[model samples]
Target: MTTNSTEKRAVRTSVLRASFLYADGATRLTDKYHTSPIKIAKSFPLKDQLAVIVMDASPGLLEGDCYELDWQAREFSHAYITNQSYMKVHPSSTSEEAMGSSISQTFRLGDNAIIEHMPEPVMLYKDAKLHSTTSVHLGPGSVWMQAEVICPGRTLRNEQFQYAELRSSLSVYYGDELIFAQRQRVVPGQHQLAAPGCWGEMTHMASFCLFTDQLTSSQIGLIKQLVDDLPATGDHQVVVGISETERYGLVAVAASTAAWPLQEAMRYLWNHARNIVLRKESVYFMYS
Candidate 1:
């Protein structure tokens, strides 16, 4: 609820809180509440499971806009959340008067529950400023999969890294112990994000985190090998790397100037990881 320059900028905030319950051998959307500019729709064929599509009623994020979201998956239930389209952060006003937008999402996964919080890439316009945070709290025997993608700007329009600032963080906790964490802050022209050791010449970067329990050393090696084998080819070059976290989790990073290649790489990783976790293939539909 706190914002900067409230007097000079018009604050547009939208909030959505929802919970999923398991009963009668199926999951139900037990609780749902949303404010302006944010809505949730369960339009998929899986009524027993919750597949929610987050709809943004507004044109896009504007200066001084803030979004707050909270989602919960009760014990033994499954939930999947996706967005309708790519998030667009438009340009702000003058440098002195420019305002930054923020988004915060919190997820609670109960024991034996599963939740997937995957959304489309965020496109930042020239001089756009944005900050986002995602917090996940997991119970014993629960699984939470999350990923994030950020693009510098529209490449076709020749607006690469013209944004003012971008800051984001993701934290996963299991019973008050932080199992995995990722953080990034980039201020174009001021930050050396394109250096040889950094993103280099890449314009888009993505990260994925998988939090589960008790993975053997061989499994972790297999996951890393899968990531290293993905081909970065054909007009959209991408480079990806994967490693095991200290807490029996997996972290994957991919970079590409084009969004599609990075997304493809993530999809491959997720499918392979799921096979390792569940011992079988599962359906995960991701589309633009």
Candidate 2:
């Protein structure tokens, strides 16, 4: 089936804005707005925090599609945000139209606020190109944690690393000071992604970052031990490393042949960090 031109361009750009506030002794989704193809599926209350799932109505991101998401948490509020499914990037129609899709996300937190932003893995199709940027601003005593997984084009189809390009940039600011910044650009045809000091033999990669003043050296050690304890067999080999940031918090990177192992490692470290920062247990969500 062919897509109609009008329908394809109907929602070239979509926006989602959500705000959480601590009220009535619990965190609540006080305000929210969304455009077509992007909406909040639902929000669930877990312990002292609120969990919200963002869902995309369209099949996947198409060429020229752009998504903007903004989230805010009020003082003492704790929120967890996740996507319902993989962020699928479709192939460009032609080499000349390889700019492809983009996603921009911004997060702001008030004093003592906490946010756990964990989304599903990204699946890039052959010839697909995607650019994603994330900016976070934290207030005093606030914490922000994010986890991301990137999968080399559909591996079963033998299209691994066939994408035109993938660029991701992230910046975190504590007050007016930039605590962490990272920029990654990968062009499969131009870069030796599988060579030493690069991705090596790993087909998937995951990154986790926690920004907060509550980070401790002992906590980093425990996180490293957690990553080391993950089972690494021939079928599902994974290599993960953790390090402290320039100022506060820590960053962990993992490379694996499959996404599941990386995801598992991310979850383990996320739980540990949450406990250290918020003194809370892991909150599970049912992904569709």
Candidate 3:
């Protein structure tokens, strides 16, 4: 299939603008813009940065739907953002172009700023098609934590890897230098993702990026040990790997049949990294 086929889908674009600023020794939501099917709310308080949740008015994305999100974190500001629940991508016919839903997000960070963007898992129904893209640009001394999770299909309905297509891309950069990038395209009909040497029966996958300029050698070693000790294989376990990135950063990738293992692994790593940087336990981000 040509790229034009994917581009020809009817576009339903929704834009969200959000920014954080440092004020009165605390970070707050300085500016925000949203519309239907995309809502933002910040009621809980964190230790230093503001915490917010992105909400979807509709249950899930329909055919030919495209969503976009734009966020900026100014200098000396901090923020952590998450969603209310899992993202559901409904199925569509394979005979038509743009037979799926697409989501795009872009982040801009200033020097000495921090942002943690961790959304929930995405559940792809049987015969479902989805395309997702995320890009982050960071200034010197900035940090951004991002993660994405993908579920094969509705396991409760005995639907696994029945989707027609799934494509995704994530990229992080600092001053025009790409620090980390990941792209994947899965067509279960042509690829044996469940076969040996592949996902090997795993029904879920997750990827995370932790970009910061404040990690010591000792802390990095400790995190490496934790990643190495993660569960490798089981009914509800995940196999995880951690690697170093430019600018004192780390990236963790995991795959499993269940989502909890990956979620817990990410939580531990994120908290560990934050504790080392801030010199305090990251209880607020975990609880609130």
Candidate 4:
């Protein structure tokens, strides 16, 4: 037995069942068969935006567990997936006294389809490292949605993720046409941590909402209501904003104290989007 006090990293892979599909202006997800108990991943559509629910996947993460996520949207459909809380990444010191995790996500959208996946924040521990890559392929007339946050590893633990590294890259393609590309890298000891507004005044930072469909007056009103209900946690605050984008799209921005607030913001937007889309069917209250 190794003398190291830290527990040996646990290696786990949960092949979560497929949890996505599209309906008439709505996405239907049936959890009838879940091999992994309550850790369910389901997605639905809110107008042109996607609303996904990943139940049982809480804020904290287990060591040596590589979680795999998947998604699919039908034609003219949209969905966004969110976690209940922040994603906790424990320290795993292997190979040269360093550790990290990798998240790989791929999307397939149909013509006029759209997807917005805004999960909770990933909390890093001291010396923790992470690499996340997302690929998006859109059908003709289709749009894509996304958002993410990188917090300064467990700031409350007095152990800042010193010597940490994080790399995130995203590639979006619309019908054989590459549209967007963005990449970010943050290495604590090597990069500038206090370069005046690099990460702002707070040690914990988070962002939300990648993309939204057409920004109609109805949608704006719904967003307004959602923002107004934002909660306050004394030290953390969630800020909301919207901007006009090309393709008649409206980009919604949700910046929060951490991943928790961002998730709350996404939930609000998802609910509002759902109501607006369903209202058109007379199935719910008209969002006029």
Best candidate, lDDT-wise?
A: 2
Which sections of candidate 3 miss by over 4 Å? Answer: 1-9, 229-235, 246-248, 284-288
Positional deviation of 252 in candidate 2, in angstroms?
A: 0.3
lDDT of each: 0.82, 0.86, 0.80, 0.56
Estimate, for each residue in 1-288, the C-alpha lDDT of model 3 and write its tens digit.
Answer: 546544556767676889989889988887889877887955355877788898888878777778899999999888888988889999876775645788899999999898888788898998888999989998988888877778888888988899888999888888788877779899999998878989987788887787766667787788777776664445676778888876657888888887766776677767776776655576534413
Q: Write the per-residue lDDT of candidate 2 for residues 139-223, one digit (tens) a residue.
A: 9899899988999888889989998889999999999999889999999989998889888888899999998877778776776
Task: Quote the positional error of residue 111 for candidate 1 in Å.
Answer: 0.6
**Can you give the TM-score per candidate against the true fold?**
0.92, 0.93, 0.90, 0.65
TM-score of 3: 0.90
Question: Rank by lDDT, descending?
Answer: 2, 1, 3, 4
The predicted structure with the larger TM-score, 3 or 4, is 3
Indicate whether candidate 3 or candidate 4 has the larger lDDT. Answer: 3
Cα distance off (Å), candidate 3, residue 109 = 0.8
lDDT, candidate 4, residue 106?
74
Best by TM-score: 2
Candidate 3 residue pairs in clash (backbone atoms < 3 Å) = none
Q: Give the clashing pairs for model 4.
A: 49-78, 50-78, 50-79, 50-80, 51-79, 51-80, 52-80, 112-141, 124-153, 146-210
Q: In model 2, which regions exceed 4 Å deviation?
A: 1-11, 231-234, 286-288
Query: 87 in model 4: Cα distance from truth in Å?
Result: 1.7
For model 1, name the residue pairs that clash: none
User: C-alpha displacement of 101 in model 4, angstroms?
Assistant: 1.4
